[model samples]
Target: MKFTNGYWMNRPEYDVESPMETYDARQDEKKLIAFAPFKRVLTRGDQLNLGATTMTFTSPVENVIGVKLEHFDSENHGPSFKVNNLDPDVAIQIDDNTASLTSGQLKVSLPLRTDFDLKFTVDGKLITESAQKAQGVIFNHDTKVSYMREQLSMGIDEKIYGLGERFGNFVKNGQSIDIWNQDCGTGSEQAYKNIPFYISSNGYGVFVDEPQRVSFEVGSENVDRVQFSTEGQSLQYYVIYGPTPKEVLHRYTQLTGAINLPPAWSFGLWLSTSFTTDYSESTVLKFIDGMKEHHIPLDVFHFDCFWQKGFEWCTLAWDKEMFPDPVGLLEKIHNRGVKVCVWLNPYIAQKSSLFVEAKEKGYLIKRQNGDVWQWDLWQAGNGFVDFTNPDAVAWYQSKLKELLNMGVDCFKTDFGERIPVDDVKFFDGSNPKQEHNYYTLQYNKAVYEAIKDVKGSEEAVVFARSATVGSQSYPVHWGGDCLSNYNSMRDSLRGGLSFLLSGFGFWSHDIGGFEDGADRPTPDLYKRWTQFGLLSSHSRYHGSNVYRVPWNFDEEAVANTKRFVDLKLSLMPYLYTQAAHSAHYGNPLMRPMFLEFSEDPNVFDNSTQYMFGSQLLVAPIFNESGRGHYYLPGGKWTSLLDGKVYSVPLAGQWVDEEYDELSLPVLVRENTILIRNEKADHASYDYTKDVDIHLYQLSDGKVTTKVVDLHGDDVATVTAKRKASKISVNTTGISGSVNVYVHSDNNITSARLVDGVAEIDL
Candidate 1:
């Protein structure tokens, strides 16, 4: 992807062609087309042997401009990201020397005669521009491949974020990232979910609109520019503009796809039978009973790969030997008010009974010679399900319908990152290279739709692993395989933060880590990770060779698990409301610190901490020393635990403290109204009744908080305002008496709801 030896010259083998000037401009409908040649037209003879690059401009939504650069026009194969074009009104102006297209507050203009940079601006202020020698039509003789590329200017101290679920440093400034999906674990440069989109600190984001592999050099190849290239005849990208970081995400999600709200019960704690562990009906019964005995709330119980027999993974059948009566077992678990999730992947092994049927029906991918593509990677001679074929999708879904009938609630759609591309052919003739990353999208979509069809749309959810640009529509995705050490836990947080910034609504990870090998986590690691996992949007305890039940570690671990699980269940009234907000406006439930505190430079690179929902700040303890480090941006924060106060006077102050294993930083923001139900035993209940509305440092302005029911509908809206020493509270859609607590620097005061309103004087 990097073509430059230095700033002055290109690498010897690559023949690069860049536009010198835009010679002509033409308007076709709403699109403005510009012709820029590789060389300047000094004479009529100079235009004889040169090739020209065509740049087309259009607008899809307000404040978003789409630019398509083409070296040579060719037929575009099927299967691209589903871009929602709402057809917003745009302004097109043509002058003698320049051509500009404006959509809402964002405009893209290019020079007509003398070549100038293709500039993007918001309200006439430059955000980023494609300078000279920035757009490339390159041919690498060594690889015999053609690529279309564009390099946009990066501002000073501009921090880049959201190149998908990356595991390294939070700020993606100097990484050479490839938008290729891989099965590598969480501690590598390769990512399971690779999105061809990045948000810049300069109030704009660029999304490459290609399903094929798009390689990006974020100030790596050229220190001053961020370059993205694809192996094709054309490259298409869109520049989304926003004055704030959240607004940029709002617009990007609007353009790509809206986030689907997972079921409310999914926000509760999920306990899974560890992968590769020996688990039968007895083992499952013991784990579920243990949770009940220990008084730890559980919502979903998942069965990993061993649910099916070995080497027959996607058979979608319950191993008869392991569970002779899967239906009865599932019913028993459901009777306990718990849901069931089973693991599945798209690869159909030859040993599976469905293999012959799939091959005969053309449900599996085939090679160019028309033979079914088979490999011996994870399973012995497995073939990928060709999701491009509709019958194949139905065939796969039919197998899952059996599971649904057996009381399985959802599926952990895993292992789509290992799809093969070489010499393979899709049923619908989709480009092979393009199908590599996009295969996960279709794979997850098929499973999600089946679940939606069987269990009502309100109950559909999937814990997917691999993802592409628009995979945010699939509700919940987890951080892939990770080690059991503290460093792996730290990097997993980084990866999840980056994934949330990529326009996802909810995310989760294994509690004690996935690839824990033989020696599982230490007792301290298990307890520490329990606190972090329970605080996430979706919580799951899963691992590889060892069980993840807290009692397996120690009694302290059991207590830690119960404590946080109880806290999370009590906070569902607040969490589900914020979750509904994310579904409505495409904001992530788990947010990177910079997304909330964009004005504070100290939070721009802090991945050790994050904002859970919209009100709480969580800083996970990563080291074994029990020392916690976090920053609060220019506000007064109150601990939801133990009634402690944190008044940070400095603009960016980091608080370092030591604590027992029971707690870490879980701070409530100032001027916020948080609703909680302390007596609620589960995640799904009537959120409107018997709830405590805690007003933390209520500012002078009116702040309204809305609560949603288990079905994700508005049940109540509580508004409070304070001026000086008096605070007035008003409520709508509330009938029963409510308790109100006022949290301040000195102490906490309590009051009761009188006639659906409350007045408190300090």
Candidate 2:
């Protein structure tokens, strides 16, 4: 995608036609159009045989500006992203020298009859610009391909992030990234969820409106600009303005899609029958019973790919030999108060009975010819289901409907990343390259709709693997295919943080990594990863060629699993409230430190430590030695586990300490009203009753916190005010009994709700 050899000249084969100046400007009610010829139109004859880059500017949502640069308008086939266009009222004005459009606090200005400078500003302060020679319509003479490129100027210390679940260095300043969804593992540069959107450290974000391949050179090619290009005759992108990072994401999600909060029970511990491991009804029961025997709370039990035969995947049927009575087995698990999730893919292998039927009915993706598209990558002779076909979607959902009727709760929708593009044809005749990443959307949408039909809308969720722009509508995507090691664990977390920052609300990863030989993920690593995984938004234990049962490791692994699982169940009162807020406001459940502490320069590059919600900071111990290193911005922090307080200076402070097998740094911020239920053993229960309201630091101010029920709906509100030696408490919609504590004071202060009010004197 790089057309220039260096800063001075373009490569020899690339004919780069960049706009020099805008000769004329026109305005309609909704849009501003500027015509910029490739060369200086000094003479009247200069405009005869030359082409121009047609620039159009408009607003979809408040404070967001969309820029479309076109060389020649080509016919666009139908599979684009599901962008929400509010079409807010915008101000369009064209004077003699400039054409500018303003929407809310954001404004886009284009100069007239001068050097090309398309600048974006917020409140009259320059954010970024498309400077001279930055917009190009390039034709590679050697390859006979055309591309539209746009380079936005970058600030000196500006950093870029979030190209969708990237596992490399968190700051994406000096990287060449291609937005292509691939099935690469967590340790590679390739990502399963490659989104053509990036958030800037300058408190804004850019989204490339191309489902097809969009390559980005983030200060890598030019060293002072972020260059993004797509192969086609046109390129369209949006610049969303946020004075803060959270506001930027709030607006971004409004344009893409908001998350649907998953059911509360889905947040608990999920134990899976690992891939290629021997598992039957008996084996699954043993693992469930084992968890019970060890005093660990389990919520869901998942069956991996072997649920069906090896080659007959997405028969979407049960392997009779292994699971003779899937219906009864699901009931048995449900009777134990656990849900069931089985793995599924969009590909239907030829060995499956449904494949021939689909091929005959034209339900499978077809080639340029009349034959079905067939491949032999993961399975033998598999064909992708054409989700664009309504009948095909209904047929596929009908198969899942049988399973859902048989007591299956949800599905782990997997393996949509390997979609074939060459000579492929979708039912709706969508562009093949564009349909590659978008196929996951349609596939997951079909399955999600099926589940929502059976269960209610609030009960539907999918553990998806691949995603594009609007996949946030589906909840709970996990980091896929990680190796069993400490490095991979760190990589998984880095990738998960990146994805959350990309507008996803919930995500999870394998407890002890997904890939290793059986009898792997050594006991120490299992114990460490268990703590990290249970603290994630969604917790699941899965592996390849190994059973992720905690008892398979040492006794300490079992103890560690029980410890964290119990802790999560206890904190459901606080966690679910934050989750509901995250879903409603488009803020992430697990966010990077910089998002919360934007004013501190120390947290800009630190992804190792993250804010679990708005109150707690969790630093997972990555090394086997149990030494934890974390930084805290100027405030008082107290460990929830040990009640140790830290008073960090205004300049920020880093702490290095060692932990045991079952402990790490889980700190609460000053003046935080942390609600918990320590004695609870279930994830879904009445959160308003028998709660532990721990007020950290008890700073001399009033703070209010919300309490939500199991359905993620607010049921009550708690307010605490500390005035000198007295801390007064008030509650609404909550009554009866509650225990209160001061975290920095390190003592429990008993309180009873008398007429929805209580007061404790220090």
Candidate 3:
């Protein structure tokens, strides 16, 4: 993807043509067009053999401008992303030297003369511009291939983030990234989900509209420019403007799609059968009973790949040898208030009984020679299901419907990253390169729809692995395979935070890691990871070749796991509200510290600590000694574990705190109200009953907070105001009884019950 040898020269066998000047500028009702030639015209005779590139600028919606540069025009490739744009009317003004197009608060100016330069502004303030050699059409003369690339100027203090769930450094400066989905583990630069979208700290975002491979060089290929390119004759990108980073994400998600709200029960702890480990109905029951005996809360139990017989993955039939009575086992688990999730992939092996039928019905991906594509990787002679065909999607959904009829609650849709690209054909004739990353979107959608059809819309969820740009429409996705170590654990957090910035709302990772059974995770690592996992939006304990049962490590691990699980259940009232916000708006549950503290430069590269919700900040312990270094932005923060108070300075300071294995650093922001349910023993409970509202450092202002029930409906609203020594509380839309507590420095100074309205003395 890199074509330059240095700043002064290009690599061999490459010819890069940049727009030297704009020869002509014209305006229509909706767009502005400019013709830029690679070489400048000295006279009218010089235009005889010269070719020019057409540059078009238009606004798709308010505050969003789309730039398309083309050398050759062709029909748009099929299977484009589903984008709904609110195109408002725009006015184009042309003069002798400048041509300006204004839409809403955004204005784009282009030079009417020969010089090709573009300047973008919002509300009369400069945002960014494309100038100099920012736009180019490169040709590889050796292979006779060409590409189009565009670079946007970055501000001097700007930092770029969010290029999908990246495991590298948090700041993307000086990094070369490729948006190609792969099966690499969480420890590498390769990512399972590659989204061609990035937001800058300077309050603007850029999105490449290509579903195929898009390469980005963030201040690497060129120091002051963020370059993105695709292998085609045309390139299209959108510049979305926002005054803040949070607003940028809102606009970006509005352009794509927002995350769907997951069911309340899906927020609790999920225990999975370790991959490649031996597990039967008895083993699963023992694990469930062990959780109960240890006083650990359990919600969903997932059966990994071995649920189906070997070499017959995705058969949709239980392996009778391991699970003799699958129906009876599911009934028993359901009676214990647990939901069941089975693992499935889109690949069907030749040994599967349905393979012959799939091949006959053209439900599998085929080669150009009219034979079903076959390979031997995870399974023997596996063929991928073609989701492009409507019939194929129906056939696959029907298989999952049978499992639903037998009492399956959800599915873990995995392994969409290993799709074959070359010599294969889709049923709808989609480009193979684009389908490689987009296949997961269709695959997860089919399964998710099937679940919604069986279990209503509000109860549908899926644990997906691979994703592309629009795959955020799926409810929950987890970090893919990782090794059992401290480094892997830290990388997993980095990946998750990066994913949240890319517009994914819910994500999880293996509690004790997923690989390296010979050298299992240490007891300290398990205890530390347990704390972080249980606090995630969706928690799951899973591993490979080794059981993830808490007791398998040590008794202290069991106690630590139970403690955190209970703490999470206690915070359900607050967590579920945050989840609903993520679904309704585009805010993320797990946010990087900079998202909340945008003015503090210290948090720009800080990935170790994150804002759990709007009110709480969590710094996870990574080392064995339980010592962590985190920065607190200037605020009056109070510790949630103990009633300890810390007043941070205006410049923001770092604190290195030592914690026991039982706890980490969780701090509540000042002047915030957090709602909790103390009487709930499970994740899916009546959040309206016996609610406790904890008021933190009410500094003479009015603060209002609302709580939602199991169906995500508003059940209660509490408004509290402080006027010197007295706090007035009022409630409306109350579903059940509520109690209020006033805390100054994490101590409840006064308590009262809500009887229409109440007042407490501080």
Highest lDDT scorer: 1
Model 1, residue 60: distance off in Å is: 0.5
Query: Per-residue lDDT tens digits of candidate 1, residues 1-762?
Result: 799899999999999999998888888988999999988888999899998899999998899999999989898886889999989999898899889999999999998768647999877788999988899999999989999999999999999999899999899999999999999999999999999989988888899999989999999999989999999889999999976888889999999999999988898999999998899999999999999999998999999999999989778898999999999999999999999999999999999999999999999999999999999999999999999999999999999988998799999999899878899989999999999999999999999999999998999899999999888998799999999999999999999999998888899999988887566698899999999999999999999888999989999999999999999988988899999987778889989989988888889999999999878999999988999988988878988887788888757698999978998999999988998888877888888888888999877879999999777888899999999888888998766768999987857888899878998886
Question: Candidate 3's residue-wise lDDT over 191-270, tens digit each?
Answer: 99999999899888888888888999999998888999998888888888876778878878888888888999999999
The runs of at least 3 residues in candidate 3 whose Cα sits more than 4 Å from the true structure, single-residue gaps closed, are: 735-737
Count of clashes in candidate 3:
1
Q: Estimate each model's TM-score.
A: 0.99, 0.99, 0.98
lDDT of 2 by residue, 353-435 (tens): 99999998999999999789998988899999999899999999999989999899999999899888998888999898999
- Any idea how many clashes model 2 has? 0
All candidates: CA RMSD (Å):
1.0, 1.1, 1.5
Error of 1 at 92 (Å): 0.6
> Backbone clashes in each candidate structure, one number apiece?
0, 0, 1
Q: Would you list the clashing residue pairs of candidate 3?
A: 22-114
Better of 2 and 3 by lDDT: 2
Candidates sorted by lDDT, descending order?
1, 2, 3
Instruction: Write down the lDDT of every candidate, Cα atoms only.
Output: 0.91, 0.90, 0.87
